[model samples]
Target: MVTILFFGQLKERLDTSRLPLELVDGSKCLDSVAELRIFLQTKGDVWKENLAYGSALVAVNQQMATEDTPIKDSDEIAFFPPVTGG
Candidate 1:
């Protein structure tokens, strides 16, 4: 199982803060962040827009990750809008 954390507008759009996904054997190797976006899109348009947009950021195991990062079972992935703070 993979734990996906949603934040900010993403959470609001998805209507949930967290999502748990079960991965089959072939699904374990996620090569790009774009793939994750597509997976979330399966839920509906709201998830697709919020996550697939250019404004959102991705993290793996609490550290920022790019699309090429590999994903494994039990990995913690987080998605959120870009942060702006003074």
Candidate 2:
């Protein structure tokens, strides 16, 4: 199983603050950030738009991650809008 979290405006847009995912059966194969995004997009159009490549910032287990970053069961993934500096 894995945990996904949303933050900031992304939380509002998605109408969710967290999700617990099970990587079993057909989903057990997910192993990278890009793969995860693709899977999540299947949830709906909102997921597709908000989580599109490079659209949101990501962190895996509290550390910054890239598309190729490897993931596994029990990992925690977070998504949020890009931060802007004033």
Top candidate, metric TM-score: 2
Candidate 1 residue 15 Cα shift, in angstroms, is 0.4
lDDT of 2 by residue, 1-86 (tens): 89999999889989999999876657358889998899999999999999998789899999999999998899999999998899
Compared with the true structure, what per-residue lDDT tens digits does model 1 show for residues 1-86? 78999999888878999988765547454445667777778778777777775768999999999877777788999999999899
Off by over 4 Å in 1: 25-32
> Residue 69's C-alpha lDDT in candidate 1?
77
Instruction: Rate residue 76 of model 1 by lDDT.
Output: 93
Residue pairs clashing in model 2 are none
Runs in model 2 with CA error above 4 Å? none
Worst 10 residues of 2 by lDDT: 21-30
